[model samples]
Target: MKEPAHHIILDAISQSASDIHFHPTPNEVEIHFRINGQRHLYKKIALTKYKVILAYFKYTGKLDIGESRLPQQGSLSFEENKLSYSLRISTLPANSLESLAIRILPQKDIQSLHELFLFPNQFKQVRKCLKNKSGIILLTGPTGSGKTTTLYAILKSFMEDNNYQTITLEDPVEKSFAQAVQVQINPESGLTYDEGLKAALRHDPDIIMVGEIRDQSTAEFVFRAAYTGHLVLSTLHAKDTFGTILRLLDMGIKKLELEQSLLAVASLELLPLQLRKFKNQRAAIIELLEGEILSEAINKQLSPLTAIDFQKLRRKAFAYGYISEENCF
Candidate 1:
């Protein structure tokens, strides 16, 4: 029984899968692995068999095994072939059964900005923004759009050159960073994002990375924290770069505040490459809003100009033979 669970995890790692989802029904549990951005069915197991496996995960993740009526989140670590990994496990109650999802994060296998971004210019733009000593840089995108991956990559890159005191506030500290202080947010214990930022500020960190801006209060507090002369990095859910700006404004970020501490916003969309060398993997094409354009956007003066938006980047990727025609659309 342990062998089966171990083999499934190792196989998923070998395939570079990001997530393993177990959908529990009345009779069986259907397993799927999300590679790049697409889900592929793995295999199904009997309800009885899955129960043992789920129990194993719960035990390893330190979650409550008996209580399946409510959602729970926990994490467990693994070491394989000299590489370290953190599996973030989340279980949700469905009907009378419970479904589980595991997010696999490679601790030290972070891709550089060059390898993560489809275009070199976009990579350069991100690197440039990280040079700021103060202000806020936002990465916006849909779920599973590689925002977390990019955030980790850029943080690694920035830490290498600038020896800033970095700190992170994640709902569940996904991976351990040897160089930065990692804090987990557990609101039940009274450590919310707003509270985390306040405590993080007391640490005199030169760089503060919020795992995400989940609500308006969190967003507002982060912006206020940015004014205290610490460079902040965070992710927000939005459709596009322009939409990210509008979302911030709607979240009670005044136009003056935006002009004061907003550094840039990069909206990411992952594109699976057609090139054989990059098979079964995806790279990001970014819609970066910065400089004069970001300032114009602060006042709600964004233009319909053919800037480096998603469509243009996709067209560029197609022209450069980086992506297939199917992805270009």
Candidate 2:
């Protein structure tokens, strides 16, 4: 409803900001844009103007405008320059004032698998991981990492080339896919990641992509689904590749189940490239685990896997001139 909201959206798209943050205080609201894995303050909007924009976003996103003491999350679509973007809006209660966050996601695929992975063979490995028709492949990363983008690209490629039944259980249904059945997680509707997985099994899907493994229930469901002979793809948050194992173990996944149902793990890291064609952009390098190396980790025999981690990834990227020395360790 406000012109400032439209202007902010336009400017954020122009700058390719991944997210927009609004910090409201008693005086003014500080606006920040997250670009290339970092946040920079854009400007400060008056408390009056900020409230109007916040209300506009919440109303458009279909969140409860009357409820602010609790938290809320919803999605809204924005169309500009012949392209559509999905804005995931979230509100949090604060001591001073309610805070707002918006994550901007393009409705369509933007980068290919090649562009996503810095090294060419690593791209090949990701494809190899997907070749198996059973077990789960987990993509681990921190916030602002390329886990979602990488997973979407691979899923699209498979949907285009093969005649496979793919089903995704995302919290908000991030992107639209023509052939695959995408389910959104809504606890209010008696549909959650755990419930969705049970329903997905009845569909005889060739591939299942769980949006994320957030808790023990979801993680157990995912592992059980994979154990039943369907390929499962999901994302997890961890510090690194080995950290993925510890996280899963902490979630109560047994070693034997991992050996049987876990296919591969790829932890993604976004690096600022030093190339001409990638100006002002960053690419992902993965700490890939597969086959024997994966088996070793599953068995708690990580002694031989010392050379594989984020340090190795950064070293390889720096050695290959994909990133500058200053950007590497």
- C-alpha RMSD in Å of predicted model 2 compared with the true structure: 1.6
Task: Provide the clash count, candidate 2.
Answer: 0
Candidate 2: tens digits of C-alpha lDDT, residues 68-162: 89999999999998899999999999875789999999887545677687778889988888789899999999988988888888887787679
User: Which stretches of model 1 miss by more than 4 angstroms?
Assistant: 301-306
TM-score of each: 0.92, 0.95
Error of 1 at 56 (Å): 1.9
What is the C-alpha lDDT profile of model 1 across 36-101, one tens digit per residue? Answer: 888999999998988899899999999999999999889999889999999989999999888999
Which residue pairs show collisions in model 2? none
Stretches off by above 4 angstroms in model 2 are 301-307
Instruction: Please estimate how well model 1 matches the true structure, expressed as its whole-model Cα lDDT.
Output: 0.88
As a TM-score, model 1 comes out at 0.92
